[model samples]
Target: MLALNWHRPLMLLAVAMAILTLAAIGGMTIDDRTLTGLPIWTKAVKFALSVVIYSVTWAWLIAQFTRWHRIAWWAGTVAAAGLGLELTVIVIQIVRGTTSHFNFTTPLNSALWETMGLSIIVVWLATLVASLVLLRNPTSDPARNAAIRYGAGLSLVGAALGLLMVLPTQSQRDTGSAVRGAHTVGLPDGGPGLPILGWSTSGGDLRIPHFIGMHAAQLLPFVVIALELSARRIAATRPVAVRTALVKTAAAVYTAVLIVLTWQALRGQSLMHPDRLTLSAAGLVAAAATGAVIIIVRRRPPVDPATIQPTRTAPGAIR
Candidate 1:
């Protein structure tokens, strides 16, 4: 069993986020207030849950570092603080009955939004530092190493994609709306959106790619764990090299899909209504991933007969 030395600050933040998630859920049931066509507390609940996952993941990852432990710990602390501040602002806005993001209607609102933007940038930089530390100090497990490094790198890309949402749209410029940015493309926010997530259903929703990218760290690590578990039961997946290759292939396919989704959203295409081009791109990625899996499985090393232990026989009756 692998021992984890969890970061104190990050673990505490995760606990706080868990509490906030429960509170937000309670708020959702009773408030009955709506924002952007969803319950006002909905964003709070989603953000709180996200922070819980984020903090816990960082804490565990930081604990894996053998060298530069101090740097990793400080980086995690900064990330936790930044995330806590961001969540605090979101909750404050929720209580005030206004949107937390891109709201420049008043000086206060603008200040809060700007603070969140700054906090996130800080968080991103901290994550980058921690990722560098992890890469420099890799673990003994090849599959785990690939999962951590690739997941961390891809997660940065995902977080950076959020920048696209901050640019003012043509409509916003033309109308001089108080809101400076939006999550949806080719259509206004608060339009027909997916339930719970509130991603635009009528047009392009940048949040789709952003969400996928940010969670790569969790998803990739989970893939490695699943493969590790499968190895115990499936002889073909027992080799370390095979598992690492599979993880790298999965990461590559994940990146390709993220790129496709980002492109599709930027072109103002609804996720539910992908055009032929988008569908073709996605299909190509899927086919490549499937082919890669088959090849990896086929190329796995043959199991050594010597390594197999013989079953014990009965001493008296069977003989």
Candidate 2:
């Protein structure tokens, strides 16, 4: 049974949206008039599902960080309201037979767009604040600490990419199209794309990096947990320091990958159409990441087991 808390409302909202998404999928077939030439409400459904997972995961994770219940409550509240409003607007616009994002069709639409954008910013700022708080109050477990730091930092990068997405693309400015702002890079909006993701298969798409970076909050911690379990399985006497170093190394490599993806998109290259130069650059990034990891691991001195505390089992805490 799920506990009743600030996060619970958001989870319920997510459930509702999920049901609506299924309904949309079942009721609405392909609509050529929509943005992506798919169902008009597809993006809203995707955003709903993403937020559902994000809200629940964030709430659970934050609870494990600090025992300050007030801060956790407020963070969860802001996340719920902000994401809820954003999704509401998107769904409303879809029902009205229009695009939700980058829509300045009328004064009302522009106002709605601005409201949605501001709401997103508010959520991002709240998340940033909470992440900083977690950093300031470090966890006893070094492995978890590394995960929290890396997750928070990468999550910020992801939010910043949201800012990038909102800005008017150079192509949009050049063409002076009615929709003067779009998420796509090399290709125009609603162009050839992959199924479901709608990522431009023919050219660059900013959403790729945005998606990858945003989920780092969830991914980094999962990696830490896995590392911890693996270490225990090997019956390593002292694993905290080693795990911390490994997490840092992984974070560095993850950031490098995000950078490479961003660079690739900015160059108007499709993800699948990477040139020789792109491949070479990626290879260099990987090599550098590996070298850094090797150096860190070598430098990591063996920690005395006597100095370390037995790992505690907190709710949602990394084992």
Candidate 3:
């Protein structure tokens, strides 16, 4: 059984964020407005959900990679503190009825915003370090190893996206804005956006890749686990190898999709409108992924019935 004793504090923080998320949902009913033209509670809800997901995932991963117990402790502590401060500042701004990100009107507001930015960088670095540690000390199973490697690598991409968000964009340069760059492309920030996510459908939005890449930590492991469970049903000697190939193939496809979305966004194209380049990239990704899967499955070892577990339950079986 996977144990979470290594990062108990972060797990508890995740529970707290879950509670805050419910409260944010309730707050949404109040209809308070924010500078982003969205309800103030929307920020809270997003941050709360993100914190919950990240905290839980990190806790579970740290538990699994128990070799670096001390490193895990420091990483978890930094993550909890950094994320907690970020949410606190966001919620505080919400309460004050002001903007949180890129706000530089007043010195105090600018200071808070800068602090939030620093916190994000700190947390990102912590996550990167943790991922590197995991990569250095991987599990014996090939499929599981693939998950750790790809998940950590993709997550670094996600973290790097944040750094990009801070850089001044062409729009900001053209306008000579005092503050830093914004996340929205081809349109001003806080304009009409998609429901819930608020991603700009009118133009390129960087948040899409950030969201997808950030969740790779959860998604990659999930696929590997599902495949492992499925593999247990058969008695193939090369189950591990087969699953490893599939995992690599899946990671490749996932990276391709991320690159496509990012390229489209940079081009100021809407997610609904993919040009020839985007389509061609996606087609190639699909073809390559499919070919990899087919080759791995075809080359899988013969299933030996003798090694397969009996379907019938034993007398002392808990079931």
Best by lDDT: 1
Better of 1 and 3 by lDDT: 1
Q: Pairing residues by index, what is the TM-score of model 3?
A: 0.87
lDDT of 2 by residue, 1-319 (tens): 4633536756666677678778667645755446566667678667877786677776666666556656766776787789889988987788788887888878878888989999998888878777766766777888788887888789789778877778787767777655656667866778888877888878888888998998888899987888867876654424577778788878988898999899888787889889998899899988887887677656657668899998779899776
Q: Please give the lDDT score at residue 246 for candidate 1.
A: 94
Task: Please give the ranking of all candidate structures by lDDT, highest first, separated by commas.
Answer: 1, 3, 2
Cα error of candidate 3 at position 152, Å: 1.7
Report the C-alpha lDDT of model 1 over 56-165, residue by residue, as the tens digit: 89898788778999999999999999999999999999999999999999999999999999999999999999999988888889999999899999999999999999
lDDT measured at residue 83 in model 3 versus the true structure, 0 to 100: 92
Per-residue CA lDDT of model 3 for 1-319, tens digit only, reads 2334648778777878889899988888876565676777888898899889889878877777757767867888898889999999998988888888877768888899999999998998898878877876777888888987898789779768766567777877887776666777777778777877888878888888888888887899888988877776754424777888888888888888888888888887778777898889889888888887778888956678999997898899898
Residues forming the 10-long window of minimal summed lDDT in candidate 3: 1-10
**Model 3 alpha-carbon miss at residue 55, Å:** 0.8
Global lDDT of model 2: 0.77
Could you estimate the TM-score for every candidate? 0.92, 0.86, 0.87
